[model samples]
Target chain A: MTGAALRLDDVACVRGGRMLFRGVSLSLTSGGGAMLTGANGAGKSSLLRLCAGLLPAFSGSVVRSGGVALCDEKLALDNEAPLHRALSFWAAIDRADAAQVDAAMDAMALTPLAEVPVRMLSTGQRKRAMLARIIASGAAIWLLDEPGNGLDTVSLDLLGQAVGRHLSAGGIVVAASHQPLPIVAPVTIHLPDHQADAA
Target chain B: MRLLWLLIRRDLRLAWASGGMWLPVAFLLLVASLFPFAVGPDAALLARTGGGMLWIAALLASLLPVDRLVAPDVQAGVLDQLAARGIGEEWIVLARLLAHWIGFGPPLMLATVPAATLLKLDAAAMARLELGLLIGTPALAALGLLVATLTAGLRSSGALAGLLALPLAVPLLIFGAGTMSDGSGAAFKFLAAASLLLVAITPFAGGAALRAGRD
Candidate 1:
């Protein structure tokens, strides 16, 4: 399966007595990319989370492809779990290939750390491990929040290549970041800067 | 049907991998043994108290594993994902309760035999002990599941879980222990009646609590 198109209608989100995003609407097609850009506190992460259904939008609706893989900056790993177990915990439900796990691990430069527990890894390494895990999730739509947070020059380029490959494979990708994103053909929707109710 | 099996197996696998299955059974045994030590070795006292003691230990042991039924997996975002997979939330709750039964309920029933011995119960009492445990442990798992789902978000949930479960569990305990005592045959009938009601309504209550957690 490649990817399904995603659509949102007037997706408004409010938090902490503040309106994060209001009357936000966007549609992303297969092989399509939308860059979510905003200064801090402008709801980039919040918007991405809403798209992933990890957080509820205060108003409006979000419809996305099933099996949406969310790769967040925090790298939600259970501390007591081994890298293999934590990575494979949910994937244990899906009958996927060992080859896909290997491909994801190699793509993210996480093969060597596969034996380490999540608590043993450094922040950057944990992030990379999470990227590999979600890649193995085989999700059609990749909602990434700060995928470029702590990556060095090389990993940033690696991430750009990953996004490119994902898009070229007819997958949908939405990335929320503050810094200049490393992708091409991305429909740049500035969160606060480009708050038009239509996209 | 395949997904249903997959879910049941997945829950079974996770329960096994967590080293969670045996802990409560062991706890029940240890708690049962302590009663003999604390009260001295009067065999008649042990015989008379055995059934009630076994029921009490089963109740406590059964509750120990309730948090494992959903909270950790929920915090990990696994349960929400399962719900999103077009698996009805009710089935998820049922699957989880079944898994809890496998992990917490059956072993509890098995432990009652040893508990009967520890409390110096005779053969007739042992049979009734088995009956009480067989019916009551499921009720325990059901009510525990309900409380566990309700208290998922609280920090001091262990206390809250006991608070929520023990009151509801009282009837099961009374009927359960009654089934084993030298009390009249009528007591055993009442135990069966209570067990039937517990089995019937627990699923509905547990499902409702699980739905609340999803929202």
Candidate 2:
């Protein structure tokens, strides 16, 4: 976790022949966090994907050191499995032990719901489950897209504490959300400022 | 290697949970049972044509589970999560191919026994049919999976998958059915070669398709 870093240099993104954003650049070392603030279709999600190496930048480059974990809108857990088991699958894939899965569930206050099927969870619980997956991943870089969408007050607090602990451990976090998040992202990139002109 | 096994186990569990593992076997049996009704109870004719009919049934049975193979995982974000974990798309597709073959191939072979009995096939013909299926079903599974990956995100992908897979499967069908009558070992070799080719290329082709489908 010590050497974690994420850097994007003057990146431009085009989708379906339309430029979404351009001239975007940001760099974060270990213990650093960046908040991407933009409206819908502004490419906040695309930018996060670009940073994760899941999407290519239309121009420029994204460079990262250390592993990455992304928590997006879609819950990747198996719907039929119990919450803990669903999370454990990913933990195993991430090569983390059962202890981390248990710890992540506890961190999100999801211990009580561990035995419940994933599909049975409400929206807020599902959101927390996604967070627990990120926590259990133990990746040095966390890319969270709208991590607070359906969370209530207590759950949101749990998210804040998780981000705090991750940053304190010298991990990098890049969260994209239109709504205000509880963590302190010292570098804020309001994407509209980088929007490309329409031809 | 452990990760590959883990993925195959997960896919098998999902296939079992969704009842997809049984669809191909059931379809095979249903087609076998229906053939006699369509052709009447002419025992000689049944024995002569049963092997070919069963081959056709197996080919169509392979298609039944194609719709459930790749699309659900892609929509559920499973592929993206695995990709983010540094697992290659080819590994994922290879694991899925193995799971798919396990889910349908052996069961379909077993189901062929009862299906053959229903079709009034003799012992010798039944042996050939089973051998043909054992060698050919992996190719069928691979074909289905490859087509599933290609058509995963398209609207009405199930119908599109059939149209895409059936034509490519012509060689397997020909060689598989050919084995039943060609007393020589030539047909068996052809069937094995075709199966090997499909099984070998499915991982790379399906992996590329999955990666390309990602946005």
Candidate 3:
């Protein structure tokens, strides 16, 4: 993960024939973190999607090296499966071993709920599960979309610690949230400043 | 290959858990039983037309699972997670095609035994029906999955999927049924060709639909 890098060169995003943002550029290498702050419909999630290579940039080049894991509103786990099995499914896909899955569960304080069915989890617990998935992914780049949503202060602190560990181990973290997160992100991109037009 | 297998396994488990794998088989048997009542229980008439009726039933049965094939996973963000892991959409779609066939094709074949008995299909007609289904179900599964992906995020996707897949499946229905009467074996060849083409193109087309829908 040491060589991981994410670079955007004057990126622009257009959705539904409306320009969301433009002239946004940022560069982050291993151990770097950036925060994206904006109101709803300001393209924060789209920017994260673009970074994960799930969506193409409307214009300008968005480049990345190393694997990416995205944590968004969607849990992406099997609803009926036990929490452990659901998390293990993704760990298997990411090619991460069982030990990493265990550690991720531990990090998010999800070990106790491992045997619980995913559908039974509350909103905050589900958010923790999503973060655990990202942690277990072993990807060099993490694109988190409003990761703090539905999280208690303790869980939020746990998320912060996890992101800290990731950066210290030479990984990149790019998170989008309107509310301030616990992680230290030296660069913040206020999307409204990059909006294509005021109108 | 391992990733494909993993995906297929997950899909199979999900289908089994949801009890969706049985729907098509049940529908096939139901159709088989209903045909006798609809046409009156004339054994000779059944022996003559039962194979064709079974073919139509199989076609309709294949559509029963279409709604579950792709929409739930797309809505659940499983596809996006797979994409983020650098897995190609083509590979994902291909894995799904295989899983859909595995869940659909074999069970439907197994159900055909009782269905054949219900329709009073003779052993010769039974053999043709089974063979046609064996070769043709892959295409049916592919068509259903392709339509599932296309209509995954839309409103009333279940009803819309049926409309979208029925017209596309006409050729399959023709060739599948033709296998019973056409002693020339040409219908089998055509059915195999259509199966091959649909199975080959579905991954690419479905992958594209998924990607386009993401936008």
- Whole-model lDDT values for every prediction: 0.75, 0.93, 0.93
Indicate the residue-level lDDT of B70 in model 2. Answer: 91
Candidate 2 off by > 4 Å: none
Query: Candidates' interface RMSDs, in order?
Result: 4.0, 0.7, 0.7
Candidate 2 has an lDDT of: 0.93
Deviation of model 3 at A175, angstroms: 0.9
Candidate 2, residue A132: lDDT: 96
Instruction: Give the Cα error of residue B139 in candidate 1, in Å.
Output: 2.1
- Model 1: residues >4 Å from true position, as ranges? A1-3, A15-18, A39-41, A54-56, A73-82, A193-199, B4-14, B37-40, B83-87, B182-215
lDDT of 1 by residue, B146-195 (tens): 88788876687888898888888888888887777546777667766776
Write candidate 2's Cα lDDT for B1-215 as tens digits.
99999999899998999887988888988898889999999999998899999999999999998888999888988898888877899999999999999999999999999999998898999999999999999999999999999998888898889899999999998999999899998999999999999999999999999999998
In model 3, the runs with Cα more than 4 Å from the true position are none
Of 2 and 3, which scores higher on DockQ? 3
Clashing pairs in 1: none
DockQ: which is higher, 1 or 2? 2
Mind giving the per-residue lDDT tens digits that candidate 1 earns over A64-122?
86567777654555566677766765565555567777788788888887778778988
Candidate 3 lDDT over B48-114, as tens digits, reads 8999888998988888887788888888999999998889999999999999999999999999999
Give the per-residue lDDT of model 3 (tens digit) for A59-86.
9999999999999889999999999999
